[model samples]
Target: MRNERKFYIDGQWVDPLKPNDLEVINPATEKPIGVIAMGTAADIDRAVAAAKRAFATYSQTSVEERLALLEKLLEIYKRRYEEMARTITAELGAPITMSTEQQADVGVGHLQGFIDALKRLKTREVLPNGDVVRREPIGVCGLITPWNWPINQIVLKVVPALATGSTCVLKPSEFTPLNAILYAEMVHEAGFPAGTFNLVNGDGLECGAALSRHRYVDMMSFTGSTRAGIAVSKDAAETVKRVTLELGGKSPNVVFADSDLEEGVADGVAQCFNNSGQSCDAPTRMLVERSAYDKALEIAERAGRQAEVGNPEEEGTHIGPLVSHIQFGRVQALIEAGVAEGARLLVGGPGKPEGFETGYFAKPTIFADVNNDMRIAREEVFGPVLSIIPFDTEEQAIAIANDTAYGLAAYVQTGDPDRADRVASRLRAGMVHINGAPHRYGSPFGGYKQSGNGREGGIFGLEDFLEIKTVHHPARM
Candidate 1:
């Protein structure tokens, strides 16, 4: 087993204040692949203090200098991209194909997005009233990322902080720390100043809370469950720090009758089941036009059956296991709930896939004739599960799509360009996907309402890490 039981702090890999070790298990094999040292409040303090001290100098660095460092980091990332993909597969049970294509790719994509955004950013500008407006780093950021899309969330938060000339202390999910460790190595090699970036491995209760509540921390950027996001907000409130979250979502996919029903439904199922259906913005709820509801159900059922569950070690289009046994259990329980709640289980039900008795794999599930109130429709199972709901009118479809507390992302599938534009404007979501369009790099990735505050990616991401200031001079001068 690999021994990775050290925390990266102040540009050095150091031992934890106390020896609290945690074993990282591979969900594909249900075995320990490595061990990482779990950090405590004291460790958070050390990391946060280092970040605070570094911010004094790092925040004042020129944008060109920061951009150069980021370019170096990006170069290193590209050179070792394959290692990152393999690391994610080993730790997170993501299929090697998806890990390489989507998971690890985000590190490069988002980093380049930030680089471009920084280049386009105007740090100093003059207002109409003869006041000079300047954008400055917010200082000493406390970044918390989840396990599902490890590198994706990390880059969304970390790159913007560094690009904006802010120092940060990261607390990546303990379940997937290997990739983070690799990233720390790249950051160090890129010649970032000591104390500019630090990482601690631990659960949310200790290291997370400590980072959020620390008096020296100026901002908190978190990506996780909605419940945990609330906790982070509460903790940060004590110190009045800036808190930005990219939390949970039960995003809706509206398929109109005019759409190519077969293709649309099939693509919807694939999106819902992508990453083993662990993505926060997965369109778990499919609101179909009543005229084509039955046909959509058939397409979804067929697509669900076709989704392959395979080994993360192998290179194939199949999805791997859930990140852990706990997640597996949660997914199983939700599957059971869908059945109990009276929704028709159109394709898969509860249990591990055949020939995969030892791993944390879940059957790709689809529930048709689902109402908005069903537990399967309301909750985020975070698995390969799809819930199909029927609606009669365009008004009704928009209503159902916006019913959820989460407004992260919504999808519109239609043949009519006018209807697509009309419905996209009405949907209560930060991002709208039209006719199976994918979210591209540099686009703002976030949501409204409970999906969390602030936007990430490109200029919007950089804006979140910046504080605005206006300098006034005498009009006579």
Candidate 2:
């Protein structure tokens, strides 16, 4: 059965004020998969009004009640997990297996983490000076999510807003709106209040700008490129709304001579190419000690070669095409620029991988003898293109790593745990992965400098949606 195209506003699937429709394309097939209603300023107004109205009561709800609501949402999300995976596969061209495991599963993990965090949170506390400090909902929040890891980004913002008793108007990426629409359906099934949560699907100029400029919105949490994050900050400034941005990154993976060469190189390559290299925090820059540079390059090239590129629906296809034709063009341009600048292309260059000519796919690329000044090493290409830069000394490597404008994420691999920790401490990044450690759900995740401000995940995420109020009492005589 074909689904009706509508926005979720005021607890109902409502038509937009304007009928701007966008065609969702499967990057794997280069075909139109579905059509979605694109929102405008009017649509944002409607969603914001609904959220503002719902905040009056929802903000006052007890922690236990809110927890129960989140639990209900979790249950509904589980029932539709497969559907969510399929929707992402169709819309974003993420391999179905990868979507199910990494893409959709992370959303579930985030919601569950929120549920657990809320249970232990202390909303009200007594201070030393006979004062009461209360952490209250920050009112109607504006949530702007990115296309990469669509569901995970949405749930990270939404789950915490709900956990903190904040109402929200969400502007999900128009490119990948199917998973969001399905998510809205799941939220509706969870039976949230009429004005508690509203989903508005649209582009950055229309819906996103409206959310940022809306007076009723007390906070805006945005995740996307650093350029767009700057614009969102400027828009939110007019109303002095609290803004939390998780922006772009060109993260570095540093390998020491003492590290496990095979494991370090393999993990770094996998992390870079995961999600077909769409992640903002992918270890796109690899800095290895001069002594182990050749070994690391060999291992990384093998890992890149092993990546299977094909239709996202097919099993064992490790890498998929870029999200859209524009992205494909951008990646190809970057690859060409790298070659023109005289960097050695070790394996895989411009154009689609062998036997896959229909979609927007690129060969798994690796560039060696890359200087830190090269565009490929400096900018965020956001494809399966890996850069290998060798360092003669540890100090030089750390210096090279911190040379970029982005400070989102960094990875350090070394047999000596103390040395690894010391090196990680000096890197100018928000999150550091030591010895290929897995991401912890409840830990704070964010960036520094141009990368972004504030944190997401764990109590830090909930706090972003809250405002603290302190009441002082007279001391006993």
Provide the overall lDDT of each model, using Cα atoms, as 2-decimal numbers. Answer: 0.94, 0.89
Root mean square deviation (Cα) for candidate 2: 1.2
| lDDT by residue for model 2 (1-477), tens | 234368889998899888887788888887788888888899999999999989999988999998888899999999889999988988888899899988999877888888888888888899877799999999999999999899999999988998898999998888888888888888888888898999988899878999999999999999999999999999999999999999999999999989999999988988888888899999999999999999898898888788778788876648788899999999999999999999999879999888988998988889999999999999999998899999999899999999999999999989998898889989999999998997888888899989999898888888888899997877863
Q: For residues 1-477, could you state the per-residue lDDT of candidate 1 as single tens digits?
A: 889999889999999989988999999999999999999999999998899889999988999999999999999999999999999999999999999999999999999999999999999999999999999999999999999999999999989999999999999999999999999999999999999999999999999999999999999999999999999999999999999999999999999999999899999999999999999999999999988988888888888888899998898888889999999999999999999989999988999889999989999999988999988888889999999999999999999999988999999999999999999999999999999999999999999988999999999999999999999989988
Estimate candidate 1's alpha-carbon lDDT, on a 0 to 1 scale: 0.94
- Every candidate's CA RMSD: 0.7, 1.2
lDDT value, residue 53 of candidate 1: 88
lDDT of 1 at 308: 92
How far residue 174's Cα lies from its native spot in candidate 1, in Å, is 0.8
Candidate number with greatest lDDT = 1
Off by over 4 Å in 2: 1-4
